[model samples]
Each structure stands twice: as structure tokens, then as C-alpha cells.
Target: MGTGTGRKFLFVLGSARRDGNTEQLARLAAEQLGDVEQRWLWLGDVPLADYRDVRYPVSERPEPTGNEELLLDATLEATDIVIASPTYWYSVSSSTKRYLDHWSNWERVPGFVEAMAGKHLWAVTALAEEPHQAGALLDALERAAVYLKMTWRGGLVGVGNRPGDVLSDTTALTTAKTFFTA
Candidate 1:
């Protein structure tokens, strides 16, 4: 609502399966922040193409590309929090992991950490129908958020036919609202 500052979110979707379960969850959470600016980066579309080098080094900084710069800039400008949600595979999806790998350096990007310093980060993972289906994945997300210095807000769990099937669950919708309010 406040264009004057950081009141938006940069959402990174980690499922390559189009319209897959995780994408739907991303959207549901997104829908909560009505009219809020959003940068939805689907890791599937980006495909982890090699770059000259990731400029976010702890010791030195480099100019970032439009995408990288914008992503980092928006992160610096974000007000509420940074949300990374993905479909869990053995652990977190490679797409999500790779996406995070991109954000490894906090020192390079100006104000990046200050913007994200104490903000909350919520992660949602879709898993196969099994016991503790998303355990490893949740663990990965926990460690990632910790390493990134983001406040681990909470987590969500969903299981369904495929990707979008998460929408049908009442818990999914409720969980999204809960995180949004936080």
C-alpha cells in the first residue's frame, strides 16, 4: 500500500512442473497481500543459467544484472518479509536451492541485509503422501533461512494430486492467511 517504501514481497517459486502444487501455494499466499507489489520469479523459467559470476561476495560487491539487481534491489526494498516456497523433493527442490544459492552473499548488495535483517520468512512445501513427508525439506529450509539471517516465521504442509491440488485444502488457505498476518 505504501509505495514510499519496503512493503512488498519477492516470491520465488521452486517447482518446474507448471501449475504444480507449489505454484498454487505461492499464489494463494500472494493473493493475501492485496495490491502489494510482487516479483514472482519461477525458478523453472530461469533454469539456473550460468553467469559471469555471482557478484554477491562477502568481501567485494559488483554491479548486478537487471534480474539479479532487481531481485536484490527489491529484496532491499521489501518491507514485510521474503517468502520462498517450493515442492519438497528428497529435501527442498533443486530449483529453490539453486535460487537461494544465488542469494548467498549478504555483504555485497547494499542494504540487502538491513532490509531483510530481522524480517520473517515463511516456507511451504508440498510432499508425497507419506509419514513426515516433508521432514528433510523443512530442515533444509530452516537451515537456509538461518544462514540467510532471516527470521524463520513458520511453515506450511500440503499434499494432493499434483501441483495445484493444494488449493482445495482448507488448511492451505488458512495457513496462508496466518502467515500473511504475521
Candidate 2:
């Protein structure tokens, strides 16, 4: 459903495995947002190549030739952004990391900084250990929001080691339901 405020959600999932615990938690939480327009970008299915800067004498926009261009377009229309990833070595997955790396290119677009202003950002993660294990990744997301002049709407970290383990985490499920509602 629409939130009257015309909020849109962009959910970028970073887990490489389909139907994994991280994906389960993200879907469970997104369902709570009702029918609000939500764009789901599964990094596993995207070709997010590394960024390569080609210096130009004049200020020229770097052409996006990969999946990150799609993400950028969606972000422009979204009022809320959700970065969901599985913890890998206490950090975000490689796919997620690569996705974030493209921000450098986005920043080069005229008025891109102003366009991101006032947008809200949130995050979700599934950890093999305790939920606290995703702290580093969450912090990086928060920092990015601050840098972009966006609001950090907090995050949800679920404890899950197996495919459906996140389903058993009542704390995470309850927290997810309340994240946007509250």
C-alpha cells in the first residue's frame, strides 16, 4: 500500500545464494511494508563489475555499463533504501561491497548529491552467529547515508546459519515488523 507520503523502497539483496537465510529475512520484512512500491535487486543475478575510472580532461559522466546502473535509476525514485546482505568475514558480502563501490561514479552526476538529499536508508542482514556480528557492515551503511545527506532508519540483523534459521528468530521478525511502522 502507498504510505500517503509517497514513499518507495529499494531493496538491494547481496546474498549470492537463492532462498538463503538472508533472503528469507529480507522478504519477511518487506512484506510488512504492505503494497508500497518496492524494487528488489538481487545482486546474485546482476553483473556488478568493478569500477574503473578513466580520467578525462573535461568533466564527463562515467558511463555505467553494468547492473549498478539499474540500481542507480531505482534509487533516484525511491524514498527509502534497504541494503540487505549476508555477513562475510564480519563485513558485507563481496557483491554488496562491489555495489557500494559504484557510488563514486554516481557522485559525479550533476545534482546527484542534491537528489539523494533527505532520502531514508535502512539495512537488513543475516549472520551465521549472533546478530551483533553484522555491526561493521551496518556502520558502513550508516556512514554512507550520512555522507549522502540521507536519514539512517536503523537496521535489522537476524541470527541464521541455515536456510530457514532466520524464521525462528522472533526477535528479528518482531523488529522487522516495527522498523518502518515505528
Candidate 3:
């Protein structure tokens, strides 16, 4: 149960906007990991418009590129993963959504369950506060956590989808770090 300092940690940043609130938090977490052996893969840049076939087609199996497969496979080899995203419209971004839709593929690999049986996962979400707003994104995330069979270390929310909003919010930053550590 001890990840220690040498274990590999993978963080999948899922934001469409570059340097947005969610991306900033992902960067902050990466910086704070401090000597724990980690790698941050920014999948937010993948043009989601091209990912219409998220669940893959029934006629043929989806084959991952070397980099894509590496991210999936590394979950078994890595100590943990942080799935960070901006709560867009009401859930994770299309980029991250597409990636998560590919989760079913892992079951086909040998020893996949035992390999990733108890791996830790954290879902971080940043949402803008609005009139009568609710944690709809968190609800979607909870379902995913249930299906993934991974520990949900919780999330980070903010009223900052606009530029430079979360920058000075001490409470938001504290919330982010608290969930990460918890």
C-alpha cells in the first residue's frame, strides 16, 4: 500500500482549453508530486471532434497507437493516476470522455484485473459556479469510479472557468490539495 518515492504516477489532463483552470491544477499537482517519480500526459490537446467513435466500432477492434497504449498499459505498472478535467457543460471534456470510453479494451489483456486490482485513482474537477448549480459532473465521475473499480480520492471544484479566476482563491487551492492528499 506504500507508493513510496520511486513509483510511477500518471496524470491524464483532460481540458480543451490550454492553461485553463483544470490544466493549471493538473500542472500544480505535477509540480507538487516532488521526486515521487511521475509523468504527466496532456491528452487535452487531442481534437475531440475526431473522436466520434469513442467506444470503437463493432466490426473491428480499436488499435491504440504506441503512445495511447502506453498510457493504458502503464496503469498496471504505475502506482497511481489522477484523472483531471474541467467540468464542461456538465461532465468531463470530450477528450477525456473518449479515453475513458476505451476502458473496456483493457479487459481483454491477460492478468489485467489482478494487475490493476487495487490501483488508486483521483478524479479532479473544476466547475464554474452558477445559479442553481449542482455537482452533476461529480455524479458522472462517481459512476465512472464505480465502474473502474478504483478508489475515488475525491475531487477539486472551483468557480473559475473564466480567465485568472482561480488564481488567487486560497480556498480552492486548499480544497484541491486536500483531496489529493486525502
Candidate No. with top lDDT: 2
TM-score, structure 2 vs. true: 0.92
Q: 2 or 3: which has the higher TM-score?
A: 2
Report how far residue 5 has shifted in candidate 2, in Å.
2.8
Best candidate according to TM-score: 2
For candidate 1, lDDT tens digit of each residue in 31-122?
76777677776766656544334463545555566566655565566554444555455576776665566675534566765556676676
Among all windows of ten consecutive residues in candidate 3, which has the lowest summed lDDT? 45-54
TM-score of 1: 0.74
lDDT of each: 0.63, 0.83, 0.65
Per-residue C-alpha lDDT of model 3 across residues 1-182, encoded as one tens digit per residue: 13465567777888776778776766665565656767667785433234334344543656556655776666667767777788877877878877776666655555765665566776666667651242676676666666667666666666575866766667767665645445
| Positional deviation of residue 34's Cα in model 3 after best superposition, in angstroms | 2.3
Native-to-model Cα distance after best TM-score fit, residue 117 in candidate 2, in Å: 1.3
How high is each candidate's TM-score?
0.74, 0.92, 0.78
- For 73-167, candidate 2 gives per-residue lDDT tens digits of 87788889888888889988888888787776777766768989899989888998987878898899999999999999888899988889999
Off by over 4 Å in 1: 1-6, 50-62, 80-84
